[model samples]
Target: MARYVEIDDVRVALAEPVEVPPRAFVGRDKELQLCRVAWGISSDGTELVDSSAPPLNFRLEGAPGLGKNEIVYEIARRLDMPLYIVQGHEEFTPEDLALLLTPDPEAVYGEVPPLTLRASPLATALYEGGLCFFDEINRVPDRALSPLASVLDGRQYIYSAMTGMNIGPRDSAARKRFRFCCALNPSLSNEGHVLPEYIEQRTLPVIEIDHPPFEDVHEIIRTSLSPSPDFLVAFTDWYYEQERQDISVRQAVALMNYAMNYEQHVGGQKTKIFDQVASFVVGRRS
Candidate 1:
């Protein structure tokens, strides 16, 4: 059952505890342990005070599709913290971190001006001490990210050009208590943008996630396909070989599910299903 916590006297839902299927994640015991430790540091005030630690900020960096976001989702789940997601892109602006001009409910008449507004999504979430996930952090431009330096440092100061106001120190001490975590793609020649050095310096406890081992991959396939164990074993074995040749686990899962569904829809024959999967692996499908 979900639990509720009072934040600024407003109650928010804390998702119910659920069993984390071993298949969903494999290997990386050390990384999992580290995440758990960081979560404990953030959630338990007694532990934080004893260790003289502030909210643990983490930067999870890895190759694309390596389950970095999944780790963050799992951590949030285990900690029972409210999650707010922010997608970083070239168009993102400093206003994203500050206040946004949302529709005002207090506006009179059926017509409301777009100029009339409310707080930004991040600020609103932070006002309630919610966990904000900055997805693809490096994709956001350096100038756009400048405003977040203070916020990441646990200060909530934000300059709003729209209202010509600098609203923050929301409750003073607690204003500097929001937790920030981020995920970024590993810097590559093809990557779109680079994170500033200053922003890099502010991030702590950098964690890197690598692809799971072959056995773990097989387990993920099997567990995800538990309803059809026989087909799962065969499909996993076949995809395990494909993975050795550089196929992604995500593609493997997708192909397997597609093959199974195709078989069900057209005659329920294993031979036809295997052929469909093979075509997908070979990139022969139209």
Candidate 2:
């Protein structure tokens, strides 16, 4: 069938999904390399399709705001394919993983509006050989992930009851190009998130992203806020020491940002802005 075939009352998006590069994906070259390996790619830009265990899936584990989303953005840009994203949460349901039939935007309410099959990222990636990133996947409940187990396992297909379609790579070339990966927050478990073991086993290389080194963190701050003062970098790096486990690259940037917004309180003293940000926001969590 054609990529954009209209089957029955449903219309599939045959064209590749849109891909936008991340504006400031700072660190994690090593993590990106591991993801490339999981996707059957090698250091020298060769495909390892014939490997003994050729599985193109990954589960990226890290604390919130440690640049997990940024890694996938880089991968999508490198692959030069369509990027599909599915956000996971407590209320995530199996139906959310398939094609959704919604009122067509082009049709008005009075007219007989054709229902458009708002295809899920899972199905879109499978159909068009693209990258699918499941953000905060651990937040999704056990039942919601059942459909995912089949896709990740030897079955290599997902049955969308909404569209009554079994979505998978159309041919060998499509299969070789499609990639799937997930980002998970370590704290989600504490928030009562349960990852189904079947899905866990199907996934490989649960890569853990720890905080970047002091130097890297400093550089990230410097590069992120070019023409920034040296004191800002020194102070931010020092603040990081106070919350080794709690702080992240994102939080550091926020502090700089918060400081800038609270500049009026500093009376034009740039360094004093740091104090305002630290003290202004209590119970700060990233």
Candidate 3:
């Protein structure tokens, strides 16, 4: 007699979660290489061991839609680290950096808890030896930046009011463990926000990226197009020439998808499809 044990259905075995593709952004090889260099400096123990040695910090500044954020994402990806994104804004405060008080469940209904809250997710991640991606860093107020000065210098550590504890005196290992990176739009004469000189001093070796070359832009479109086809590149180039301006490759990919869907349901006419794409691209500018 053969004895057999029942097995769970293979289909019932949960499939590995699909990795979502990162957001579409165009080329920035030079920026990415500089980031890698900074990352290497941060990871090497000897670099930070000497108190006189400067810390490794980077600022990536560029025009809007130039892939600053994407470079940060890619650096974290390549390093196999988690990314914590903090979006900077004009109203950002110290509470946004260190902690804020919140209503504790144990507290009386009318009373607020006195203890400090955990820093923003990004700050906590930075203290915990992870990548912190601060977007639009130039927009944060100067006063609010004081709390981060020590951490940025690699000399001060974060103090969590929630735990009544200091997070660092980062061991050599911890110093070599984490990295901080930021992205921001360059401050043009017309821009309202400006980063303080102190904050500016902390960020070194600024890297700037530009919109990708046409070939790279075309590749981004091809990769993101839902129904991949060889002709997609040619079509995208034509659209770009006709428009006489560049929108994100992401926008182009989206327009292609929308046009394809419209063609299938409305009519297969190429002119109709082109019109739909034009509405998304050129029409937006007008």
Pairs in clash, predicted candidate 2: none
In candidate 1, what are the lDDT values of residues 1-286, reduced to their tens digit? 3233443343333322223333355555677667656544444222222244565667888777667766766665655555667778878888777666554444467775334344554554466555667888888888988877776664565565555655454463444345577888886415647778878877768888776776766666666765377676666566554444344566556667777777778755563466556766546423
Task: Give stretches of model 2 more than 4 Å off.
Answer: 1-3, 6-10, 14-18, 22-24, 44-53, 108-112, 231-234, 237-245, 264-266, 281-286
Score every model by TM-score.
0.75, 0.85, 0.73
Which sections of candidate 3 miss by over 4 Å?
A: 1-27, 41-55, 103-116, 159-166, 187-189, 228-234, 243-245, 281-286
Q: Between candidates 1 and 2, name the one with more favorable lDDT.
A: 2
Off by over 4 Å in 1: 1-28, 39-51, 105-116, 154-156, 167-169, 172-177, 187-192, 222-225, 243-245, 267-275, 278-286
| Native-referenced Cα lDDT, model 3 | 0.60
For each of the candidates, the C-alpha root-mean-square deviation to the true structure, in angstroms, is 5.9, 3.5, 10.8
lDDT scores in order: 0.62, 0.71, 0.60
Cα-based lDDT at residue 1, candidate 3: 20
Give the distance in Å from residue 97's predicted Cα in candidate 2 to where it truly belongs.
1.0
Query: TM-score of model 3 relative to the true fold?
Result: 0.73
Ranking by TM-score: 2, 1, 3
After TM-score superposition, the amount by which residue 78's alpha carbon in candidate 3 deviates from its true location, in angstroms, is 1.1
Clashes of 2: 0
